[model samples]
Target: MKLLLYITLPTILFAFYSCKKGEVAEVKQYSKLKVTVTNQYKQPVSGFTISLKTGSRSISKVSESDIYTASYEAGGYTLTINKTGFIDFTEKIQLNADELKEMQIVLKAGEAYLKLNSDSILRLPSSSLSSIVKIQSNTKWITKDTSDWIEISKAEAFGDDEFYVQTKANLSDSIRSSTIKILAGDHEQQVVITQYPPIRIKKTIGIPGNVMTQTPSSIKIEFNQPVILNNLQSLYYYCISGTPLQPVVDSNILSFNYSCGELGGEYPFSISVKNTIGDTFAETINVGFYLQQLHFKGNIVTHFVNDKDNSFWLLMENPDILYKIDMRSLKIIKEYPLFTNARMITVNPYNDKIYIGYSGVAALYILNPDFTYKTIPIKLDSTRLKYNQYEELTPELYPVNLVFTKSGIGLLSLSYNGDVGNSRFWFIDAAHGHKTWYTNAEEMEWYPYTMDVNYDQSKIIFTNYSLQYFTVFDSKTMAFNKVYSKNTWNQGDITVASRKDANVYFQQVYYQSVVNIETGSNTNATLDALDAARFDFDYGQKNKIVGFRSWNGYVEVLDFTNSQTPIAYHYYRFFNSITNTLDGKYIITAAENGNGDSWVSQFPGEWFREEATQSSGNTLLKIKQYPSLIRKSQWR
Candidate 1:
């Protein structure tokens, strides 16, 4: 029965068997994945390899044709495509058994090369325009400006285009520069831009050429462009002769309101003006002054021979050297060395001979006009020397203060060995070279530091240091007429000036008092707080007294007719001595340099008085003028 059934096979079975035998078919557990690669421009990409990966297993031997085919198992697979000049493509794919899947991939081209129209750029700081930078590239580009002053109108753009780079106005004096970077994918280009500094023009200063009747109120300067106010101080200078003046600046105008001094002459000055950017402009100008200057090699203690030619004999201390200076040429014609420990020098008005009193010896050195000299010993009366302790009866006469009368009589305040028993005031006949009388018999321990003769040479006003007393002596008889004790008048290092009214004005320390020489009555004068150690007084007409604070470099003018408050007070540097011409038309101040040299400055008395009157009520003027005066008076 089984044989008969097998022989009679079904037609469907026979057809299935014949089809399987002729095709040799096998069941597949994988799928075919087709990957097609194209560029961003939609063009086919060749020479690319496609990798099929699953877990840690991968098949990367599949090369790219028109389409890339890879047999992947029925699971999740990762497809990685790589090619030159294109961005690699990667994707995850899912395949079913015996299923055919196609994947379309687009590749991005590599970074495009970027080109700039110019690699370097230059512009002026005054330029207000923006610069346009053109880029030649196919890829999208971006720009970055590193500086805040530098601006980019278009920071990023697609493809090649023109970008704007702008800059603000550069107000600075220095040059400024910046760099801009243009980036396109991996390619980059840089543009360097530099801006030059602004231009500055020279300015002109207008100065008055005429003689200044008063202090200049203002000085104007014209400029082509606006300038910085702070920079003006460093750019301009004002000088009289060679002395510098500190001027206040208000915009382009400079002002000076203090007294310019009484010197009368042509004052040549130079101005070196510069801009904020260091551009310099020079100008030389001359202005007339009412005063003159005479330089000396040493500190001038006394001067004689006031003439039109300005020739004078000067007595200097600290080595005892004498000099004859010719003011016209400002030269020292002659100098003489006096080998003596002298404290005071005086010129005999009758014979014009020089007399120097010694502090170490009881002698006087007489110097002639031809430089010849002789020493005369001072003789003390042994009968009157009762308090003298020396064994020789002739003690060392230390003459500290000396004053000569018009009749060639010398009043010397002397001390013997600085002892209390031998201090005296002596009278000597300067013309005869002999000591006539002395106060040794009347007073003991009287150390006189200063002595002054009255205008008529009738009275001598003497002040003592150790024993505080002011004594008045009869010039003819050498007798003590009156004595002011320390309890009544506590003054030291006194200076005396006789007025035309027979009134004596005296200053000791900071106290000023007026005494009636006829009656010996004193009235205290108003005085400012003076802290100086040395002071000098010059009494002019109209009850005006000019006081010089030597150590502090201050000049104070007091009008006795007015209140005690100083009418004019000014401060200067290196001011040591003060003097006035005999005619009282000018006031001269002596300033010492660091080199031990000195300069004489003359100022108009009338101008100074007028300025003081004008500035009396203006507190602002006082405050402003004081500092400027001090600054200008400093040595260069």
Candidate 2:
């Protein structure tokens, strides 16, 4: 009994020691997790799969209704909720002992949309056929009302589909129109339907002829088929006589006569004529202008001459239109309509691509050969916003001039309406996917009246006339080099850098002077002529500068290389803008009268020579005037 007790006592003590060293097994504590899913409107959502994962352990469950509940061991876990037709909801969760965690999740609905190919549909008066309209939609859509004269193939559709609209032949000669409404939930849009009359004007004569004399001229209107004339009413009769003579109708032909007042003036006439069948035709005609210039339906806004293509491009308003004219043929080669108003333009010398700038937007438009264009919005540094003279920042900066370097980089100048001293420059590298930079906002002050590039294309120079600030940019590096503040005596409204030297020419308010850029000194005394020249250009002839004596009817030629003397040659009319060809063969100027009449004239370069003082140059061609005297020579 003693030996047995000794052996059992050691075994019992060893077992107790092992148990104490092992430590008590940890008690597993769980936490309750509750998740509620809802939509954007706070409505409960169902049929969502919820998953919770921690290390190697994971729990997944499908919610039959809005709420999901589960229990998990205390730890950090990843939570995710997914459903079809809804955005996924994901989060990280922490569970604690004996704790209930509740989560409110909002699931966003998938995108819903509806679209049509066009906003309007036009049909003929004689056809009962249907017109198919393509549509793109992700939600169910339906027509609002049943049309009487129109019948649709389907009243409702889902997803991407098409519908047909059929209309009966119109019995009346008058035109008719209707509006159709398409509805998709909270989205609604309209489509306009119009049917025109069968009758249309076939031709007209003497409609746009000039009233060379005060006498009236006979006008005739011809139609497709025989028609009876009912009445004629004048809409706009500017510079025209009382009323047009009563028209004499013979079959489909109607004749009338109209008289006008002065010469060298434009006559605008508009008339509306009705036939016996209630059909009407309305048209506005420019009876004509005294000067035989190219006529257009839109007003000329700006123009650019492309020497490489031997073409001239014009930007016109009243519905923006771009017209390309062949300089060799003097006829329009092509025309394109624009969706936005573009006031400034330039050509990229490297790619021959066109860059257009707008008036009120911080954007540039790249025009392609196929008449398609892409817009690039410039992100303006709002911190550098320039308030106007009135200290108001409401008006945004717009591009006033756009010039490109030989390397395809575009330099744009921007300013506001008034001379508010808020002007800056933008350097854009379009070839490199539109990489852009800007001038030091603090470095720019007052208005940048003019900008020019040197012959080597290495330097770009511009001036701020108000502050007498002259700035130079390194074109090759696309960086600002320096800016010089000139004295008020040498302050000028226009400045041009010499093509061959470091000399810069300034056409002041009353005189012209030359400044040496390297020495920062005025090299020449002021040459005072009759009236300050409003426009000038580098003559491309051995440092020769030509200035147009505004309202003096003369072109002043000065030789900076020699004694700075101004030689004047008679030019019949005052010039608003002027430029010359690279070979110095031709001089072109666009002029306008106070009466709003404008014309463009070209003169041979030889006519402006010092020996040609008695030579009164003749005009080669005439066109509408251009704007902005500061940018008078963008012909290159």
Candidate 3:
């Protein structure tokens, strides 16, 4: 058994081991996160709260400077930044282990400013009163001002509010101003307060012109405050001695009447005004009293305005004298004497040459710009000449109207001793004064009282005073185009509204009618307070709105675009010719006023509006009288 045990020792050996429980330490890994914040102006922001949140954990800290730093386990986190006056920010982030992450953020400003519901400048009158100043803010606000004239009711307020700005009466001679500062947090707004003087001169009426001749006998002075004239008559001094001066005070207006007899030179005058508050003001002006009344030997039949040289051509009837007047100085520049009375006058748009029609002449007078004249015989049927009782041939037909086309072609409408059966019309070459085409006697049942051409110079329109026929013809080929008749026993004038308008306007005794050329439809409307109305062909040739005058002294405007409605109305002593300037800025009229004096008054064209009542106060220029027909350089 011993020998066997020694041989099997390796197979029966026993080992002893001990079992013990021990703890294993774990080293946590971390990631670094840095955040920097700035304002919209790129300035660093401080004191902002920075917070980080994870699945079940969160960390928060106030930022001491613009940058904040923290260390956390590698994971996803929601980062937040908040401030009192700045908008809040939030973001989700993922960080890797042992990695440094940097972030930059810009903060937008919140709605925490002050605003004023007023303009930068606040105007105040010379009166003791309180004005409301509206203030809008989201936080507390304070106001500061250094002025003795103004007092603020509320010096501080919270949020939106209104305060009273008290101002004392401005008794100083000059205007005063002050500034008010409104502060909310670090923002500031300012408003300027302006106070006007107690009393001051505002304006002067009836004395707008620089020349005394252009002013009426009565003048008015206006003041900011009610006035008490100290010395009425002694306030004015005229250049001419022994001139009468009378004044009257009516509230803020000091009206005065002055008379200077036969004074035709420059007059120097002064006006001194005193208000009830003991404020005084004076004005010295130099005005000319020169006026020339043109006493022609005969009546002015027609006139033309050459705007190129600012010259006005007047044609006299008895002696047929053509006078060129300087419109600026109102002086006669040159004169050309003719043989007989002239009926109509016109200016060639292309060459500026003047054309004249005579009352009883068979020739056309062509006057050059140099004041020289020539005549071309008008081709007439010698067999149609009529002999009077004394066996002498009667005078040739009178060319009552004449017009030129854009291509320098002339169209003349003729009447024989006011006879309706012997009416004739002629087309002439304006350059060569040659008869291109014409209508024989008895071609028309009535004389054409008025004529007009389209803007393109393609069609000719004519009508008779009998109110029975309306005719149109081709201007180039002299071909008949159309005709219309009404057979109404009334007198009227014809006008073509505009090239854009397809209707022809007819001004009758008591009504106005518009007829469409294409459809042949007629629209009629009775004019109120009008009698024997007549249209101004010169104005309505190309204008949609036309001027008209009535025998009852009514001056009115008719708008073709508005179904022939009467827009404006004015009364005159005797309305003659009415025309608009080529620029369409002024309406010039040749008529007499209530003072029994003739005048060519100019009014602002814009003053003519719907239901607008006007007076002489609206006159821009009151050119003294000459009973003559006037026209502008350019009609269309």
Candidate 4:
């Protein structure tokens, strides 16, 4: 009995020791990990989810806590902490057996932010005394003013805030700027403010009391202060009864002069001055005068010059009288009675003879330089006439427009019953009287309202009135080349460029388009709509095109050399008729005086020369002296 009791006790003791050894080995393989989440302010962040992962298995069951405690096996493990407003924190950790690791995690506050409604502000010289600014920030922010001129109403604010920025009336002629710096915690933002000097037109001096036949030498305007001359082109605009002039700035003074040939009337003028920040001051002035009369009567249809006597011939329509006046003295030189229905006149560039077309009779009156006149009969192709079969009446074709080639061949556009579609175009040999080539009436719906020839005379463009298309003909062979159907409306006038393979069409309703003769494509040519009533090409110069805006009484001069925009524009009285000299040195406009009488005036082409000088990098003063030279020379 004593031997059995000793063996059983030893077995129980060995079993107890083995169980204790297994428990110690198991505890050594695991580590205790604690994770704590806090904000940037070091405050406790609750409701944060904690995850402890090993391989593909989740070792932690606790999802949310400010402090998460977990036991993980030794070696590499992943620990993740997540919160609503804070960025997620994830990290890999090496677990040490039986070691307690406390990890402090910092969460950034997403609600703390600073922003400004606008980064910058512009204050005009004439602006009101104060400006309002809006601020967007969730945290408390402080404002600091960097300049004496700018005053902020609010220095400290929380959440979105409104601030009043105050500035004194800018008295100086210079621009000023300031900044307001906003600080929200560590975030810094800025608001910029700018102020411009006040713009003022003090007074005008040297205004002409009486503008006779000659233009005033100089008209000067003084400003309250000197201003920057950038974009000076839009600074001032003036309108005359007959001509237009551009203003020149010298320091604070604005001065301009006109030539002697412009008609006498109340010359209405306006001046607007602006500062760098678009503050404007404007004034209007009117100067009136009277001039001696030339004793002319009736509406003038055309104005031509007799090179022999250096006189201008005014062709009157109602009285059918041609009055010759000396250009220098503006005195009547002679008066010649013309055909009762004389309509159009042109000088033959090939020969110095003048050809006048009469609508009443199918004939052209040829006037020699010696003032001797002769008549040439125009025979119409009877087959092309649309006549009534029952009546013996032959429809007489009236001459409406005329064009001459470089070879002195005259192409006359004649209409029957004032219908353009059924009209005929006849080319006459200027050296003789007979017609050379007449467009076939059956195959051609072309009614030539206006005609233009290319520089090399390779193409002749005929603008149709009734038809939707204009005809392009081979100038040498007089054969049909191509029909430009892009111009849907037939009312627009056509002008072909002498230098480039392009033609400009001015639509009466709206817009002007350029057609590429080579590609047969159209593109916009003008920035604004133009009046089709009167337009002229600078033929000799081949660089500029002038169009009259009758509705607004403004003349737009387009320089093809500068493709972006019109080079020059001037305001004038509404003119019914406009024609430029062959040399393009002068522009003549005629308008009825609302009475029975009509007035004719001349404008020097040098008005646009200022823009040309600016493009060439020359001073405006250099071309100011050209008005007198342009007035003295006879352009036609």
Candidate 5:
């Protein structure tokens, strides 16, 4: 009975040596049959078992025990076995009764390789859009990533492909959708699912230009825009590519196309606004030059000069520096600092000399390069004038506004007697330091800011807050002549009658009053009371008080001819139809003084902005992005 029971032993005793050009294994006690199973690389497979069977009985399963024996009971049969991911074994072998087969089983059929994405993928959120997709399966398993097949994931039938492999899902394909099959031997497969990102369409247009130079423009689109405008650059710009093509300047109006190359093209332009649906609407216009303006709701001190060139007005900035700005250019020509407490700057354009009063040092010097400049030490030495009271022409005690006449230049030096003392004025000779008389020196017990003298250079208006008083004095004599009771109406908010001109002016609390300097009266001065309100008097424009609209309704352009019944030339609010910006075009809010403020800057194109601050060690923020008007041609 030739019962040939076969046994295949897959041993990992010694890793199979790589055969050279032609190398054969050395036969040992039992004929060697190297056996191993790996997917792609030559790695030992554990879960997969190889076996040799004879008819209904398997000879033995491979093991590391040298071999696996088969029981030869009746007739003999051939043996065969294979691994799940390996090639089938086909060989004939003779088996002894209860014999342990010691042979190697070299199983090398390669790995079933496939490719897939390890991580899960997700579609981006959709915009205002619609999307659709068709997925085709590469394998018939229709296997899901997880148990819940609906919430599909990226669990692919991972295997490197050796043959053609692609699963593109189209509306029409003749691949029977998908199919699954069980191969006779081990195999590798893959699966692919198609997905589309949520669909959306977005578009935008832009206008780029130099604020000073001509404008430049551009246009781009989102794939699904209604229409697109390309290469929209001209002397100006007007282009939009949003869905529905809606355009707007600030949000007030709509936008449209207004390209022009006709006769005389539009040089000046205003801001143009458009609706979201590509429709043109309103626009703000700045027709002329220098449209930018900054409205400073602060204080401005204007000093008068008496000279050859007659520099009529000088704006006093502070106590130390004097900035001579040309009104025409609004530019600071020279900014010189006075070495002393310069409370007053009286320039004599005729002499081309600038006189500065130093109250602290008790000195008066001419700032002009060629004037007789001198400093007077006021602690009198000889004269029996004694350290008497401080009044007009006392000493360089409290310098404020200076006055120069045939009697030399008088330094309005601010003096302090006590907490309530009004500052006194001093007088100095033009050539040498000559101290003179003191008028109303007794009233300087309180500190007064402006000690104004009348045209006669005699009467003085002293303002020490709650103590508004007036005193009349003789020029050379310095005698206390007449004392006029001063109230908030007379001296506190006082305005001197113009000796240069013929206008009477004064302020009571907040109301500006105009009366005759000779009669000390205004026959027709309106007393207006307001709280947080200010106005600019148009002395040249018919006394038209141009100010905030809510101040007194329209402008009080009154012709006080009757002195009793006041009449209006035209009831008008300055801001009624006013374009708040300097150019009368765009409107912008700026952050200042810990708050956002709105202003009309004077130089339409001037730079008006807050200071710069350091962000990190290097980063900086320019809060002063001066907004301007969008040109009208660019609006469309």
Candidate 6:
């Protein structure tokens, strides 16, 4: 009995000791764990809130920095870390008591969207119908909440899947960069935003002759605000009127002087606009002009001349005569007569002959090619043959915008015909003496800003300043082909670069645009803050439109090679001089009269210049250039 009792007591004691040791070991074996979160760049990520759960039991710890320390009972667990605009990170953590554990996590920044090919909606020329780029495809521009985007593009391609495009761009101002899993639809070819280029724009009045031939000069670009040239390499520029390469000059200003040397014509230039930001606009001016020796008299003599001297042709309104005068000698070297009465005059390609039209006649004269005889009237009237007794028709009138063709054989005229109680174009065939083609309209669809014929007469483009429409027609048929219209185009001049490809530049008051017409699906740029007008683009200077000039009494030239903005070129304040001529270098602004009135600046004796310097005395025709002498030898 004593032996049995001793054995049982030893067994019980051993069992109690084993149970106490097991509890002690459990308390010492489990440990707390510390973790740190970071980005792929190794930058510490902060404000990572982590939520932990075990069989419906849950706890949360949000860290000020990326590091966190938490105690865990011996168990298997799941952890989730979250931040704004960042992907939530999840990890499986195994823990124990009495020991330290370490873990590292990484979160990535995010991206936003894909670049849409807006050409489908905007320009989308007829040729791109095969690409199958549909509308509303790239309109998704936002990212998922709490997740950062690293790129916006195709991520996976499995067996025979079409080539998919990918975007790897990030935004710092709105969100962080992110790397995401992506898949593309089955498209055989992929298109991506390989480059984002800024837009280039220009606008100007196309040379008058360019309309007949469909050739233009550099497009003088005018913007509503300053042009934002964000990317230099992304821009592709072309002049619509002036020289093509010259559209972008040494200055940032766009200039196109296409063909100034063409004889017997007048030309103007302007710009069109585009950009990667989906910016697009056109010039406000339909026609731009460069006034030379603009005599304030109603019978003004504005002539197109070579810069070297004043040797050029003059448009005389009094008798409706076009004269080729020698700048060196004030002699009427040659005279070209016209019909009705003259109001405005212009030449083709800066040629030897001239063109004159009457203010109330539907006639445009094609002068003799040799400068000896006057151009005969080929399209004659039938002497008010048939008419309604109740309807009285007035004579046709010609606007003051025109140009000559290179051959000097054709004269392009933009005549205002109210005889039919409507506005229409009268294409006079000089060779056949008949109306060749016409675009008739009952209302004034477009008030002519300027008229231009290209050097080849293949394209005909015009701007109706009041209508804000750019009408491109077939030069041969006078048939409408295309219309460049939308909001943001100001009423101004029109011009073309006369190129076959997208190298077309045009502008208005709103912006400038440059593009290859061959791939002309979208505008190349959009700039802002500029005022361009008809009195800006002068294409006779080799089709290159030097920038706009202001009429501040002095000459205001702009150098636009440095930027989309313009810089002052030359300024000359004129002293009121009556005896001094305003044109031919030595313009005869001074005419004797005053208490003696001969029309110019009321003066007496031989003739004197007007003196604005001395206001209180006799109104003497005074000038500061010649001091007190008559500028007799300076007419040219």
Taking the candidates one at a time, how many backbone clashes does each contain? 11, 1, 0, 0, 60, 185
lDDT of 2 by residue, 304-390 (tens): 766676666777666587877654444678887776667877767767778787777777788987988888776666665666668
For 507-608, candidate 1 gives per-residue lDDT tens digits of 555455656677666665445334333443443455454343333333445444443333333333345545554444666655665666666656555534
lDDT of 6 at 236: 18
State TM-scores per candidate.
Answer: 0.49, 0.44, 0.46, 0.44, 0.35, 0.33
Off by over 4 Å in 3: 1-298, 304-340, 349-351, 386-398, 413-423, 431-433, 436-446, 482-503, 516-522, 528-550, 559-570, 592-598, 610-636
Tens digits of per-residue lDDT, candidate 6, 337-451, equal: 5444566565544344355555555545556665443544424333321223446553234434454333332324443342222333445443444343333442223334445
Q: What is the overall TM-score of model 6 with all chains considered together?
A: 0.33
lDDT of each: 0.56, 0.60, 0.59, 0.57, 0.34, 0.38
lDDT (Cα, tens digit) per residue for candidate 5, span 541-586: 2232211111242222222232221211111111211112222122
Name model 6 segments beyond 4 Å from true: 1-298, 301-311, 318-340, 346-353, 361-364, 369-423, 439-447, 455-457, 476-489, 493-546, 551-562, 569-636
Best by TM-score: 1
- Per-residue lDDT tens digits for candidate 4, residues 1-636, read 899999999999987887765475444488888877789888888877776777888754544567777777777876666566665555668889889888888876664677878645555464548877788876567889867777789987877997888887778765678878887645788777777667665554332211111334345566655654433221222322223456678777776664321222344455567655556665565432222224345776766544344456678877787776654455666777876767777655556566777765666678765667786765666665655346655554666666566566656666665344445566666655445466554324455666666544456666654444556666467566545544465445544443333554434234455555666656544345544445545543554433322334344454434443323332223565554555545555556554446655555555534444345432111011223322222211
How would you order the candidates by lDDT, starting with the best?
2, 3, 4, 1, 6, 5
The candidate with the higher TM-score, 1 or 3, is 1
Tens digits of per-residue lDDT for model 3 on 542-563? 4344443334433444443443
Instruction: For candidate 1, report its TM-score.
Output: 0.49
Q: How accurate is candidate 6 locally (lDDT)?
A: 0.38
lDDT: which candidate is best? Answer: 2
Give model 4's clash tally. Answer: 0
